[model samples]
Target chain A: MTPTLLGRIQTRWVLLWTIGLAWVLVVGPFLPLAGPSVGAVWLAGFRTLLIVSIVGTAWEFVYHGLQQLRWDKDWPTLFGLLVGLNEGAVAYVLLRNGLPLAIPGLTVAPFVWQFGTVWLVVWAVSNGPIRVLFPRWRFAGGRFW
Target chain B: MPRTLDPTDVPTVLGESDIARQGRRVLRRRFVTVGAGLGSLAMIHLWRLAGVADHALCAIGPLASPSDTYELLATNSQIPRHERLRSDSGSTIDAIWGWPGYALREAVEDSHPGSAIQALTEPVLHEFFTPKAGQVYRSVDREAARLGWSRVHQPGWVQMIRRAEGGGYWILAESLDDGPIAIAAEHVHVAIGYPGVQLLADLQQFRTDHPESGFRVANAYEAHGYIHDELLTRPSTVLVRGSGIVASRVLQRLLDDVEHNGAQTTVIHLFRTYVSDAQGDSPFFRRPAGNGFAYQPFNYPKSSWGGQLRARLETLDGEARAELIDGMGGTNTAPRRSWRRQLKRHEGRGTYRQMHGVVEKVVPTSDGVRTTIASADGTVATVDAAYVIDATGLQADPTTHPLYADLLARSGARRNPKGRLAVEPSFEVTGTRSGTGRLYASGAMTLGGHYAGVDSFLGLQYAALRIADDLAETGALPRIGPARSARGWLGWARNRRYDSNGVLA
Candidate 1:
């Protein structure tokens, strides 16, 4: 990649790393520990939680800044907030609880990977809409609803 | 505006009926072209904004003459009364003595929601109220005649005043009335609407500039099929763009034609957004909704209008409506109940298919045109089509219309990226930097301004009401207070009955 593109990626990674550290500090220890016999489930849950918290917290700040600074109240921010809040909450619970139930196995990787896959699918869907109705809406204003 | 001519004394020329003669006369009157300035884009904006405060007190002055006169006639049967209303203004509305589409009408009247906008409303309603074709222009000629106003076949501006003491408007002809009528009213509404055939120039240029790409597109609008017959049919593999109402109809027509001709033509439709086929899952006929196509409205009552959708949007705000329109992929192509059943039969046929792609460049080749398509997957494909019909959507340039050109030149109105008029919520074009007269716009031209994706019958009616509201503020057209009568209220109540009812119900 060109230096400029690599620089952007580097900046994003640094920011994510910083965020991941902060998340681990605040919610990591409080998270339930995995049962020794169910090591895989516990590791899967912890990793899932770590990724969600990191991505969600990062996106929330990004979208919040965009909405406030750019006046870009359109899709990116609105949708980001929606996905962030919902998926982030799920990841948070899984990380906190699933760690106690984990059983050791490499298959535990699916927990973290599932969300990334889903994110890619959602991102694809968000690129363009499918099946729209024309003259699709009407708006009322000026007190006389 | 009334002209006295006995029916018996009327002369027949070219075996034409009196109605046809009158239509011709109306057409002739509109041929009076004026070389008014397109004016400043700034001025246009100011005029639209100014119109709002001006129209706040404007009165629509009761539905002129025959409208009032007809109501009186309806009360008693003594004098022989015509079934329809004929005004001194020469316009008449066909009377379907009984409510023909009362079921849909009742639904609109009854459950008209309060303007409460939230996300998900557009989709929720789309599943309920579907839009139909040719409903917007159904009564244009009738409405024009009723007002004794001739339809302007060509676009232009006429000086409402000859250099008035303070200098008045150069009114763009929405429709022309008899004898150069002038309303002392300050606001001149330039509802040039969508700039007809001139709107397609960009797409025309796009297809023309790129001849080597082999994808075929079919535009909803065809003038003697010049583009379709000459270009579209020539391609072996065609990829049509857009998913609006017109696009839906064109696809149906293509399939119908292919069936009729027994041609194994491969058709790929590109929809920016995929709406659930209103046809659902019947094996024989399922079809996508109409998201981009709007044709002549002469065929409406036989087809349905988006009466329910209008009632639904009446509850949204400008930003919310924009979001809704954007979410709906900026087009209206609700599927017809019957047509859906037919389209479903071709699931595996090479004759028809749907794909999503965006065009970056269109280049012409020695044999045919080549199109470079970037599918949503980021895969690039270069294909040559015998013909390309850009049913993509309306691509208009304000500069193309003489009045808008004049207005844009002077900075009265500014053009959007799509080259349509940029207006405020009140239909005022935004760039009148001075913030002066508040010149409001209406019709298709204001697509992006306030109610984007709005070019349907109810959409037009909703816009008409907005214009009427502004006119009411101006006191030019006297105000008839909002519908509050028991009967009017009853009409409203009766209309909302189907708000929660599904189409199948």
Candidate 2:
């Protein structure tokens, strides 16, 4: 996808608000019921969302810089898939180590499940449904709105 | 209906001198798109999206639907209605936004999740998704109907575009039934597709020398199904020339007949320059090559559509732009697994062979044709084949076309370094401005300009968008901002006509 910096930021927020928020609300309530969670699972979910959204904006700058090095100035779908793992790992490390901020009652299994599921859903939606619902998304460099 | 003019009063060559001539019925519009093909269709779609009414626009061409000629050429090249084209899923012509692409639509229509998954993971985990030619045609037809294309369509062959007395241009066209008519418009868009198919020099000479053996040689872009029919019934040796996508398709068709229909066909594949391995100016830019074919998912790199290459090209001009275009240019085909397996099996059986040489001559023989070939090392060889399929591709040079040739001679328009009609980043034909009227061009005729993939579906849309924006800047049409875009898209979804005053239906 050949996303401009603005396009990347806009898509990030759109996905976060729609798919990401829906995942947090629907899956967050069930996370506590599935396993032992100390603090509010919903708080952790919202915190995770906030961290990724803010940090992802910075990642966009880095991605844009890397894009310039390539002749095509675009990322292959494979690269997009791979970058999700990188972003997830970065988010995981920060949440665990409490560098910027910490998510209460966050465990490895729950964090992995939530983060991985959100990434996959977001990726699939962006590649498929987003294009169908918002016709200008692809032409505007992935900016849905 | 246009007012009937006396046939004898029409001038042989329309110019400023004939502007005062009587008996000329001049229909005027704010915009006129010359070729009623995908390019023109895209431009009109964008204009309508920007709230331009149908009455202010005129589309002049012989075909009623934009995809008519495209469908014909595609079918002739072995891509029938059901067969998938070599186009990308997002390279849609009907919709300017390029959303709800063919893949997504196919996924929902056929209830096949695999199509959606394939589109998502294309050129990476899976082969790039290409829509069927029939689906694309159907979509274009539906869109043409929605846009009320009949209202703007002028049934005629555009003869020439001359500057009007005061402003705009006088577009002269010859109606098959009504002789000649003129259209005056402030803006003109030229998108006449490829002039015709191009045959190799030796093959052209061969056709010239042996009149009776004309049917023995055929261009891939033309109807040559008789060869396949003949091969199905009898044993014959077929010689395939060139190494483009069409060459591969033709090869696959022949091998398919051998595999499915049990035809005893021996295929000789010839390549002017056989690419055995990955090669390019730099490692990062290298294209994968194997089995005598250079592999690219599409005709050009995906980035050329809207990525870094597109941005880079806009900043370049003349020889620099031409050099970059050449770097990313050449004959390449997608690497389909089925084609690979078929070729491998045939090669193993000694039925399919590859030859590397330049064709020196082709002479008619009793059974077929004898082709003389010269290798790079000065070695010469001859092969006898019952049929020859030249897949060198279509002629795209604008000078060879009568209309473009005349346009260049009369309109002060210049050719780019690559011998195509020069165009700016906005797709305006350089030096072709007449008073308040401006001439813009797109498609194959405007290749080697600011865009590398000008002939592609997305490329045409990009050119149209650019032209629309340029016209908006000149106060010819309203700018399609966020509010207007949203409203237009709503109308598009509802299948309502686009009215500038926000009225639907």
Candidate 3:
């Protein structure tokens, strides 16, 4: 998507609220059901969601700068995938360091699983179904609304 | 003998004598979109989404669909139905929304997710996913059926567009079966595509000088299948010109014949300006280049579609916009692995060679055609070949089209720096606004307008969207909001018909 700064910010927020929130809610309850978990795992999911959204918003500015450096001012699909890794790392570091709020039992495995799944689902939907649902998304630089 | 009339006396409106002499029948509509190809179809699709009544719209041209002309040119250029076109998966002309793009549909039909995967990881992990020509044609056919194309389509060749007596425009056309017909519309859209295939001056001179050799020398966009057929039957040298996608396709076709049928064929690929390596003025803007070809995924940069470049171009005027367009515009082809491999394999076997020179002249010999080439240092040489295919691309001059020329003259429309019809950001032709009537144009004729990729499928759709929005502002149709857009997409998905009030039935 050859997104302008505004387009990137708008698309990130829109997809996070819809696709990201929905996926977190659907998978939140199942996490505690899989095995014994600590206090409010769903709450932790919401916390993680909050972190990704806030961190991702900041990341958009960096992406916009990087995009300007390139002639096309666009990111290939592969770059989009790679950015997920970069964002995941940043979110992981912040969550572990208690930047927002520290969870009672936020372990590495669960955090990885939860954060990784959310990222993948969001990315996949944005590339495919989101485009189908919002026809103007691509032409508007990935901004649906 | 011809009689001369005063220039000032010439009327913008056709007189009764002119109409009676031409035996014209007048048809009126609220909207008239010329060029019944992809561009017209795209615009009409937007009108349908806006809930414009079928009776209020008219599309006039000879072809029923864009595929009619596209397939012809494609086949002539060695891209048959089964071959893949150099277009992105989302650049589908069949649907304006571009939902369930060709990749998803093809992936489902073939029971393979390769196309889908390619679409997601293209230009880095893999080459871009391009839909086959047959698949695109089939999709367009389905959409055309749903659009009820026949109800609004009028078969005719547009001859002229002039100011009407009242406020609208009069479109004069000649119907092969029904004689002359004139259309009156408040809103007019011109999307008549490229003027025609351009032949190099040397080739044109050769064709005129030797009529018999005309069959041997031809533009790649024209019908020249006989050259390939003859080459497969005999050992002969073929001179391929240009370094664009068409040239690559033609070269692949020739090499494929040799590989599959064991035909003995030789190819002499000529380049007017060879690109030896990656080169550009700035490191940030350098295009990938190798093997005398400048590689680009598409004709224009991706940003030119909707991002920074698009915004930049829209804000620029005169020479600035033209300069930006020139930097982005040129003859470049997608980097196909198979074509590159074929070139390398043939080069090693002494069956293929590349030469850099300008063709100073071309003359037909008893056995073949001979071309005089001059190199950069003024070194001269001649090469004789059984066939020469000029793949230099098509003519884009607006004046070459009679209808466009007449409209420009009568409406006092100005041309852009690139000599194309100047269009407003809304795709409206400049200086063509009369009262409430507006004349908008798209496609190659408006190449140097606010958009860079005006000729692409996606570019055409973008233009249609802008025009639709403009019409909505003028109270011609309702603006498509999020709710309306959702309804339209659902209707499209469920194969529901569009009602007259912008609702799905």
Reference-based lDDT, residue B35, model 2: 84
Q: How far out, in Å, is residue A140 in model 3?
A: 2.9
Residue-wise lDDT of candidate 3 within B1-505, one digit each (tens)?
Answer: 0122232444666554555565689788889898888898888888888887877888888986756988898999999999999888878897766767888889999999999888878867898789999998998777676677777889878877777665778777776467778787889999988889889888988898899778889999999988888888889999999999999999999899989987798999999989988758777778788999988777888888877788779999999999889888787888889889999999999888999999988988998999999976689989899999999999878887666776677777889988999999999999988678888999989988889989888899899989998999999889876666767677777877655443457
lDDT score, candidate 1, position A96: 49
Report the number of the highest-DockQ candidate. 3
What would the per-residue lDDT of candidate 1 be over residues A40-108, giving only the tens digit for each residue?
Answer: 433453465455545555554554344332111222213532564566455655554545433234333
Tens-place lDDT digits, model 3, residues A1-145: 6887878888777877777778777775575332255336667777788888888999989888787666567777678778888888887778778565655555777777777878788777766567555666677777655
The Cα error of candidate 1 at residue B100, in Å, is 6.4
Per residue, candidate 1 scores C-alpha lDDT tens digits across B1-505 of: 1232232333211122432443432221101212211111111112222222221221111122212322232212111222211110101021111112222332354564321111122122322222111121123323223222221122222322111123223221222333322232234445433344322343466556553332333344533244334423543555566665445555665665566655455666665555544322433122233422322111221111222222233346556655444443345434354445545655456566666667666666665557676877789877675555556444365565555665665545777534567765545556542212335555566655545433433334444445545645755343323222222223322432111111101
Candidates, DockQ? 0.01, 0.32, 0.55
Best by lDDT: 3
lDDT of 2 by residue, B1-505 (tens): 2343333454434555585464456677788999899989998888887766766888888888999889888888899999999888878888776666789889999997888788877766898899999999988988887777887888888877766766678888776556677787889998989988888778888888898998899999999999999999999999999898999899989998998898999999999999998857675677778998988877877777765566667789889989888877788888899888889999999889999999888999998999999976689999999999998899978877777886787777889988989988899999888777889999998888988889888988889988988998998888766666666666666677644332456
A58-79: candidate 2 lDDT, tens digit per residue: 9989998787655445666666
TM-score of 3: 0.94
Model 1 vs truth, CA RMSD: 19.7
- Model 1's chain B yields a TM-score of 0.52
What TM-score results for chain B in every one of the models?
0.52, 0.95, 0.95
Model 3 spans > 4 angstroms off: A31-42, A65-71, A132-134, A143-145, B1-10, B14-23, B498-505
- For model 2, the superposed segments whose C-alpha errors exceed 4 Å read A4-50, A57-74, A78-82, A108-145, B1-22, B497-504
lDDT for B342 (candidate 3) = 93
